[model samples]
Target: MGSNEYFTEAVVLDKEPSGEFDSIAHLYTQELGRVSASVTSARKILSKLNSHLEPLNLVQVRLVEKNRFHVADVLKTGALDRQHLDALKLIKSITPEAQPDPELWHLIKTNLNEKDILSILGFDSQFAACLGCGLKKDLRFSINDLSYFCVACYDRLL
Candidate 1:
């Protein structure tokens, strides 16, 4: 492969229309943590890349980086359920670009829970207590505040 070309396993995070016939795909890749790549003519009706690059799909992708990254090819490897799609969204929200974390990648590739993901992001919940009631049990994490709150406290806030 050329120096500017990269091949990696990636999970599709999201996609958005770019111009008239192109799209910008957000991917969390095993080799490059997160990247946005342009897909030429991906908005067309017969776009093969568009179907393979749907949100939460696991794919092998070839990316060419010139002034910016562009998708050269993609092959769908797996499809994730709605629950996993939610996890992918959380991963996209937390991770930075081009900072690959093998542990995080493994967590995404396998059966995972929110706790595992939060731990990978350095927010361990084992010793966490409710911010309002100081109770650890039956707590839900608040990403907005980076705190845990018991069900009662959380319900009250909502």
Candidate 2:
């Protein structure tokens, strides 16, 4: 797809530093599933592209499906996070994989207050751990990240 054609709303998750100017961004969208795409001339000075690629903000992206996801370009962007910038930051921080997380992410997005969402995602609210010992919880950070521990296991501290 060209500049005019692309997916629906997407929020930038994570991007890797590439060379000196380009970066690859991971996005989660309402329409498409999880995707990561690269954008060049993003890190350039005086470029508005910097403003468009922010966490929690909704952006219109144009992309093409290759072996890995590719972002051809971003069309128009809008601010979507009335909840707060801090909430988005917290989600991005604890979420190691960014896109593939469904449960915790959903919990965050559902919360009305960004601070509350951040609380759940941060170290303070006991969100960083599974409720159990090593009781057969999924260790994989990117896929299926839900597991809970019983009170006995919690009391045992094992």
Candidate 3:
């Protein structure tokens, strides 16, 4: 590896075409948190990173950090299902840049269930507190309100 280049495990969050042939990929890494990497010639037919750069794909990437990250190599790759990919998108949409949370990483690596979505996004404590004065164990999520409430509180609102 070059002096400036380093390898890290990352998950692809989004990608946007850049210039004519290059592309920029947004990644959430275990070490560097969220970063945008430049994939040179990414739109070309022979681009190796093309197959590994899709959303929700876990990859081991070699990067050099300058004004923006430049991808040197993609060492490995893993992918999620359509539903899990959607959940990952949701997670990425709300996540801020350069913030690393091991809990979130673990959730992405292990399970992609919607039930864990709230917690994975760092809303569990707040959701729990929203449930009937903050002491309810059987809290239910409310899509309409975008929060959680105990059965009694949920009933009262209805």
Which ranges in model 2 have alpha carbons more than 4 Å from their true place? 1-5, 41-46, 82-146, 149-158
lDDT of candidate model 3 versus the reference: 0.75
On residues 10-96, what C-alpha lDDT tens digit does candidate 2 reach at each position?
676656666677766767654554566766643453145546666666678766665555666664466555556554544555444
Off by over 4 Å in 1: 1-3, 42-46, 131-135, 156-158
| Per-prediction backbone clash count | 0, 1, 0
lDDT of each: 0.85, 0.53, 0.75
lDDT of residue 135 for candidate 1: 94
Q: What residue pairs clash in candidate 2, if any at all?
A: 131-149
For model 1, give the 10-residue run with minimal summed lDDT. 40-49
**Winner on lDDT (1 vs 2):** 1
* Ranking of predictions according to lDDT: 1, 3, 2
- As for TM-score, the candidate ahead, 2 or 3, is 3
Considering lDDT, which of the candidate structures 2 and 3 is the better prediction for this target?
A: 3
Top-lDDT structure, candidate number: 1
